[model samples]
Target: MPQIMQMGEHAVIGLDGLEALLAGLKRRDYRLIGPTLRDQAIVYDDIGGTADLPQGFGDEQDGGRYRLVRRGDARLFGYAVGPQSWKHYLHPPMLSLWRAERHGQSFDIIESEEILPRFAFLGVRACELNAIALQDRVFLGDEYVDLHYRRRRDGAFIVAVNCSHAGGTCFCVSMKTGPKVAAGFDLALTEVLVGDAHSFVVEIGSAEGAELLAELPARKASAEDLAAAAAIVAGTAANMGRDMETEGLQDLLARNLDHKLWDDVAQRCLTCANCTMVCPTCFCTSVEDASDLAAETAERKRRWDSCFTMDFSHLPGGSVRNSAKSRYRQWMTHKLSTWFDQFGTSGCVGCGRCITWCPVGIDITEEVRAIRDDAPK
Candidate 1:
């Protein structure tokens, strides 16, 4: 049964109620995954029970970000989304696609599809929901469907969160993906522990989600609870501190290809590629082949590779983007500007993972602002 219950007149879900829902799904052969404190940070992992979840936890972050110590108040799922996203599951860093085996003149081509694990992502944030949708448009759209990506994404259950706290670098409001989630989640949860009754305002977006909400220990919500939940969303949206102007900005950057901004940023940019690695939307990859000296058998492995790498854009003679400055321009332009042309959407969701993870604290928004504020020629 679904954990969604009534808070008098409005729907509500308590922590215990949510655990019950996860447990219910697990019993139905679903592999449950949720956030837990690990590696000194909150990371997504398989969940055994509610005990595995980071309850009453929140994090503070800054540029070249560091997570704040756990909060004084214990509110499980209080924190904003962390650097790790659902991308790891859908677009893994490395994967083996096929192995060519041969004996004498006879050979076999063995290709295997990644058997997707049935799991419930317990606390996907609003912005992450947008990120996931963006990837779907890229990987599952009309042109080409990534078989592995489709299999993993098609059936996975989503239990999304309405972020209670905004990270210092977060610009979801500017990106127009968050503060309040509107669509694309199976089950949306807004933590409404405004008083003694710690619970979530639950809304069902799919029948599967509605059915899950029915199994929990819950009561019908009152109008007051609904009002409180709305207030919470309102308050969170108002609190978003970072904003960006994406209107016509893509063409602005593309037109200004030779703009001095690229040279200035290249000075600080290490071409380390941490931004691409951490970015939830960047999906470039490279393949490697392993074989025996006799060429009897071999395997092909696909690994996440970056354009920042000197070899990524290589041709017969040399790499097209042979310089760090040119590579940086390519990455930023593709990400911020031309991505619309290639994907029909912006590649960045403004999660700020790139800003936070870059070793030298190079902020993309800062660069955009410098470009925007530069004198018009």
Candidate 2:
């Protein structure tokens, strides 16, 4: 339910008010999860408050390279996407499914009773919002619903942050996914820093967001404040670090199944699955059942898997896609081309984790261009 008058309204809040927003969510029993500096990289973890945010920190990311740098400004949420995404929380890498105890004649099955977190994701980016939505179609679809994901997702509150600056590998603008957050958030923020004025221009997206704003000390956004926020997003869009020609991209790849570029890229690929591991929309998993020596008790667990692994395509007799070329093609085509056939949208939101985190610097955008460049006339 929306407080019709408050929904879509914009307000400005200073740093102190931003801290209060976190405290308010905490008072509502929501565990704070956001980015923080750890081990020389900005990583998402439990945040106590605004202090845990990566203030005055920015990142330099290119294919196969990432480094943290000081921004010299006390601006929180100033960095680009890190190696991890919100999927790490919503759809965990590993989860226990069930357990069984054998008692001679029959086995008793015990369902997993792990407690789910009521999360308030503090600094979600626009591209990430798209990633989360795509995942919802996978886990909460009409055909089959993952109860574990549903429970966690239902209780989560999203605080989206429009990108103040783009990353070296970013192409969310080309993907039509970002620079500015369009939808799918409880509250959206645009960090505005002009001269001595450092504040967040907040956009209320729901009744809950409106109620939360009521608790915070904020003022109505002025036309100049809103324009400044718009300018920042527009600047980010103009200087996008990368771009891909997506027109008929699905058809382009569908026509190049035998392209030599696949072989060339595969030769450089380690089949390490680093790209899939960091991809926010990737949902593949492998289930394992473990037992003790006597086999009296057993547990079933599900963990993230990747198409890059030979075992991922294994069938009854042997692996289906045995060659590295085949595996690499499967991943890229599925993400950029075949995903639309299955999910009605692209799997990639162009956050570029796959590009930046790849050990061998294989850029997905470059690969797409290579295919387009060599397509049969």
Candidate 3:
């Protein structure tokens, strides 16, 4: 057995070593989840090995647009954030809360017996890491705790990947969240491709991460390797595809509740909830209870719901946010402005998934700028 690694250790590993790392995680009984080619796009799914990674594939992302493009070099993690995030694994879209069965006017309640999965998240980006941390605040907070989220989160291992290239819609630099991973990962990897040599500079963050690294055939990272990795991250930061002026953004949105720009955006908004669906931190959900035709079995289930839906804000009389303008306002303002007051952090991570996945190409940063520009002086 390989010795467990300690914190603050740096090492270098080749492509073959990465495969060994995967096999090692499997041996520890972790279900591997990472990005792979699916339906012409890179999506997070079950992986057998590193071969399942989307190698030599980059992505093009802009407002309401996403496409996969082939890269000249065979870099395993050469793309930016895709449509699907690690949230799909952590916070499932649909979940069963509980179930009950009836017998002659008597009811027997049964808790959900859903088996939890221990996930080893591979290829997590910096912005995505921040998003995960934000959700942790929501689910694993001091006052109230989500046992389901806590159990799954506590058991998962993280493998964060530093961005080598910026996406067309990325603004993680302006958000101060990406290009270079800060923390919250078991192991962080920076892919280095120089001349004919290709390897990963690994930074061990936790004891488990260190133990996993010890399983691989890794060498101590040289000064040149560290410099190369830093250069790649710096280059990505310098070439960010988008920018958001976050200074006083919370107050800005608070003052512009009735901004005309909201009305303008509503014209193009579909209220399809794609932004909320793709957003890694949008945690809104609705619950329902239903019984079988024979009224013998009943279940309580929870499904993801967005504020944009007409029924989401329905009251005793009618829907409070009846207009598209109000729904868009609620989402954008809550995400960029009021979320700080509620969560002690900004809701948006600047991943640009909400922008790329929005059918009408509604850019959150652009809307913020417009609101600020049009605000009373």
Candidate 4:
């Protein structure tokens, strides 16, 4: 179901094309969800039409954070990424697996069933793509695939974006995952505002993308178009503030487990679980069992859990990490240091969601820098 278009180099599509693309997905019964300015933040929600998108909306971010603001123009999709990543839909924070009902002699297990709606997520950021990949490694490729997650991810489609602007807390360039769109996306778009043409230079990354491209009216690209996109990304890369040297970090944290730097961070951290809640890679969860008044019927639900919780590491002997310092160390070490040994990849995508959403403004980048810089001394 694909049609190929030979793009010379300057192939660009107008804003109308974006609408057409959404309509096409709707025809195919794909639920198109995208970003909308809500609660002083950009949150993804059901988009019945283009107007639902955050038009002329942007965000101001800081050490731990985001606040939405009006933009210069009313470009619906003009905004950059948001703290609410695609994981909210793909890997739901809380979900019900099944329910059990007691009968005269036996009990019935009612499994939760969702038709696995087809989705087309627009405006996905590069770091978000990495986050999805990391989640895939856990839910799909782990010892057990989360049936709910697999259902949502397998049938969903992606439309990634190259960031034209970076927020205050953004460090994707430092993480080497952004400023430009890369792999793991069906289609990538670079919004170009050149001379008088304000359009997007789109690149098809999959067979499905080719089919979508055929439906849109686009012209051949010129060298100038490519150059403009490169310039945008290059400029963005240079503007990034935070720098994280993750080289040999996994080994360093694993070796130096008793470092005193963690205590400093612990004193500042409240263990309020904000970091894990916003983090896309933190997948640890716990389950709850609820019973009706008669206690004959019960419903079980799984919810996101945090290692910062007092009982997160509770064992038969005792709590492995009793002190806040030990809990903080366990979290940071797992995030930047020991995750490699467990998951074979960096547990962080550097989306800065953790930093921006933290109520106390505890910066993960600064913490890592302090530990990394002092490790040598």
What TM-score fits each model?
Answer: 0.94, 0.97, 0.98, 0.94
What are the per-residue Cα lDDT tens digits for candidate 3 across 1-377? 24665687789999998999899989989999999999999999999998999999999999999999999998999999998888887888988989999989899999987687689999999999999999999998878898767778987999999999999899998888997888999999999987668899999988889988988898888898899999999999998888999998888888888789988999999999999999999999999999999999999998899999999999999999999999999999898889999988789898999999998899988898888887997
- C-alpha positional error of residue 347 in candidate 4 after TM-score superposition, expressed in Å: 0.8
State the weakest 10-residue window (summed lDDT) of model 4. 1-10
Clashes of each: 24, 0, 1, 7
Which tens-of-lDDT digit does each residue in 74-168 have in candidate 4?
55555556667787888788888899999977999999987777989988888888889888998888678778888899878788878877777
lDDT of all predictions: 0.80, 0.92, 0.91, 0.79
lDDT of 1 at 149: 83
TM-score quality measure for candidate 4: 0.94
Worst 10 residues of 1 by lDDT: 1-10
Top lDDT prediction, candidate number? 2
lDDT of 3 at 135: 95
Model 4 steric clash pairs:
9-221, 10-221, 10-222, 11-221, 64-355, 64-356, 65-356
RMSD of each: 2.5, 1.8, 1.3, 2.3
Candidate 2 residue lDDT tens string, 1-377: 12233888899899988999999999999989999999999999999988889989999999999999999787898899998999898999999999999999899999999787699998899999999999999999867899989988997998999999899999999899998998889999999887788899999998899899888888888898899999999998998888999999999999999999999997999999999999999999999999999989999999999999989999999999999899999999999999999999999999999999999999999999988988986
Worst 10 residues of 3 by lDDT: 1-10
Which of the two candidates, 3 or 4, achieves a greater TM-score against the reference? 3
In candidate 3, which residue ranges exceed 4 Å CA deviation? 1-5
